[model samples]
Target: MLKDVPRSTSFGHSSSVGTMELIRPRASKSNAIRIRRSGFQDFRRVGRRENDPRYYRFTLKRSGRIDISVQNREFGGFLGFPTPTLKVRLERSNGKVLNRRTVRGGEFGFISRRLDRNTTYYIRISSSGESVPYRLGLRTRGGAELFR
Candidate 1:
């Protein structure tokens, strides 16, 4: 049975797309919704860059699942920048960690277990001192769709 989920949320220097309110009420089988955000450079303060982390919050309105992955597109010091690095964490809204992993270079994948309905989850993405442009993708059993 489908249930109502909360849509109101607060974002800290981040953008959301696709299932903006997380997962929508599943009327019928559909393609996997994808949300993407680019974090090339964080803001700078007092002549120093702030190491603030990016956040993506979503709710599972049903027994749906998603595969989370990230990729660093910057490479070869093309712009005289260091190799891209990424660190991602998936956790419950209450601070219970579900998955945590780091990718020194290239793409990193983390598949989530079947999520319970009415539960809220968060995906946090942060970079080391060396920052570069990166992309985050979420896929599900239903085909594949991308959202800016």
Candidate 2:
């Protein structure tokens, strides 16, 4: 299955794709690296606008397709990169890197492996040989939240 997640409603064209492996990561220095609505907001009214710097939040379930769209945000390496890349690594809670892979075309897929429920996950993205980590606060998702 293929997943395409567009940030809010910026540009219908801006989107990231991932296969069953789910290794899709896109960073845009132009738009600031983010988790894309992966935060818990209890109060978001019409008057409230999503202007605060956000991170790219990917929520993967037991079985489903996850789409990562870079909408409303610009793709990283926009400075002078012709083709962009996304590097992903799963870091353990103790700060160990595991399952490292290079993903081209800003899209990735996951076949047999799915994210461990309520486990701490760390991700990094690099394009054009440049490296960047996910936002500091929003790095931990789901399981990490429950543990906290």
TM-scores of all models? 0.55, 0.31
* Alpha carbon lDDT at 90, candidate 2: 47
Error of 1 at 20 (Å): 35
Clashes of 2: 31
RMSD, one per candidate, in order? 15.6, 16.9
Native-to-model Cα distance after best TM-score fit, residue 39 in candidate 2, in Å: 12
Q: Which candidate has the highest lDDT of all?
A: 1
lDDT agreement with native, every candidate: 0.53, 0.34
Model 2 poorest 10 in a row by lDDT: 40-49
RMSD of 1: 15.6
What does the lDDT read for residue 71 in candidate 2?
12
